[model samples]
Target: MFYTLVKIIHLLCACVVIGYLIYDVFIFSHFKKNRSEVEFIKLKRELLKPSALILGLAFLLLLCSGAYLASFYLGGELGWLESSFQQILVLKISVVGLLFVFTPISFFYILVLKKSDPMRKFYHHLALLICLIALIFAKLMFLF
Candidate 1:
C-alpha cells in the first residue's frame, strides 16, 4: 500500500512535469509570434511566475518520490552496481539531473533577466528531449 501511494505520487508528478514542458515548448512558444513583443513580454511575465511555481513544486515532489521508489529495487541479492535495473535507473537519474540544472537556467534567463534569447528555445527543446529519454529509461528499467 505504501509503495503504491508513492508510485502514484511519482506518476502524477511526472505527468505534471511532462505536461508543463509540452506546453512550454509547443504552445507558449508559438504565442510569441502572434503577439507584439511588448504584449508577449507582458504575457510571459504574468504567466511565468505561476507556471514556474507549479513546475518547481512538481519537480521537488517528483524527485523525492523517485528516490523513494528507487530504494525498493536497490536492496535485492544483486548489488545495485551489478543490477541492470539499477544501471538503467542511474542513467535515468543522471538525465533527470540535467533538468534540475536546466530548469533554473531557463527560469533565470526568462524571469529574472527578462531576456529572450534564441538559445533559450534550444534549451527548452533539449530539456524536452532529456525528459523523453528519461521516460524511455523508465520503461527499460522493468524490461531489463
Candidate 2:
C-alpha cells in the first residue's frame, strides 16, 4: 500500500515536470523570441510563478517518492549495482542531478538577469535540452 502510494506520486510528479519542461522548451521559447519587454514581463508574471511553483512541488515529490521506490524496490535485495536496470537508474539519477544544477541557474537567469543578456537565453535553452534528455532517459530506464 505504501509503495503503491509512493509510485503514484512519483509518476504524477514526473508527468507534471515533463509537461512543464516541454512547455518551457517549446511555447515559452517562442514567446521569448517574439514578445516585447512589457509582454514578456506580463507573461512571466502570469505564467512563471505558477509554473515554477508547480515544478518545484513536482520535483520535491518526485525526489521523495523516487528515493522511497528505489530503496524499497530496487536496492539491496535487487543487487542494483550488478544489474542493467541499476545502470539505467544511475544514468537517470545523474541527469536529474544535472537538472538540479541547471534549473537554479536557469531560474536565476530569468528572474535576475535582464532578458537582453544572450547568455540567459543560452542557459535557458540548454537547460530545456538537458531536461528533455533526462525525460527520455527516464522513459528508457523504465523499459530497460
Candidate 3:
C-alpha cells in the first residue's frame, strides 16, 4: 500500500513537470516571430500567473518519491556500478541533473536571448528530449 501510494505520487509529479515543460515549449516557440524578448517575457508572466515555485515543488515531489522508490533496491543501488538497471538509473539521474543546470540558465540567462535565438530554443528542446529519454528509462526499470 505504501509503495503504491508513493508510485502514484511519483507519476503525478512527473505529469506536472512534463505537462508544464510541453506547454512552455509549445507556447513560447511561436514568440520568435514578432515579439521582443521583453515583450515575450511579459506575455509569459501575464499568462502564467503561477511562479516557477509550483514547478520546483513538483520537482521536489518527484525527487522525494523517486528516492523512496529507489530505496526499495538499496543493494542494487549501492552496487550501481555493476547492475545494468542501476547503470541506466544512474544515467537518468545524471540527465536530470543536467536538466537542473539547464533550467536556471534558460530561465534566468544573463544575456536573455531573443526568442529566435537558437540557443534558447535549444535549451528547451534539449530539456524535453532528456525528460522523454528519462521517462523511457524509468519504464524500462520496471522490466528489470
Over 1-144, each residue of candidate 1 has an lDDT whose tens digit, in order, gives 999999999999989998888887888879988999899889887888777988889889999999999888775675676778889998898898887786677678788889764466577788789988999999999997
Candidate number that wins on TM-score, 2 or 3: 3
Q: Rank the candidates by TM-score, best first.
A: 1, 3, 2
Which structure among the candidates has the greatest TM-score?
Answer: 1
Please provide, for model 2 over 3-107, each residue's C-alpha lDDT reduced to its tens digit, 9 standing for 90 to 100: 888888998998887777677668886887899988987997798886788888998998888887778546666776676778877777777677567556666
Which of candidates 2 and 3 is the stronger one according to lDDT? Answer: 3
Q: Relative to the true structure, how large is the alpha-carbon lDDT of every model?
A: 0.85, 0.74, 0.78
Worst 10 residues of 3 by lDDT: 109-118
**RMSD of each candidate relative to the true structure:** 3.8, 4.0, 4.3
Evaluate candidate 3 by giving its C-alpha RMSD to the native, one decimal. 4.3
- Model 2 is weakest, by summed lDDT over 10 consecutive residues, at 114-123
In order of appearance, the predictions have TM-scores of 0.80, 0.74, 0.74
Q: lDDT of model 2 at residue 11?
A: 85
Error of 3 at 139 (Å): 1.4
Off by over 4 Å in 1: 75-78, 103-118
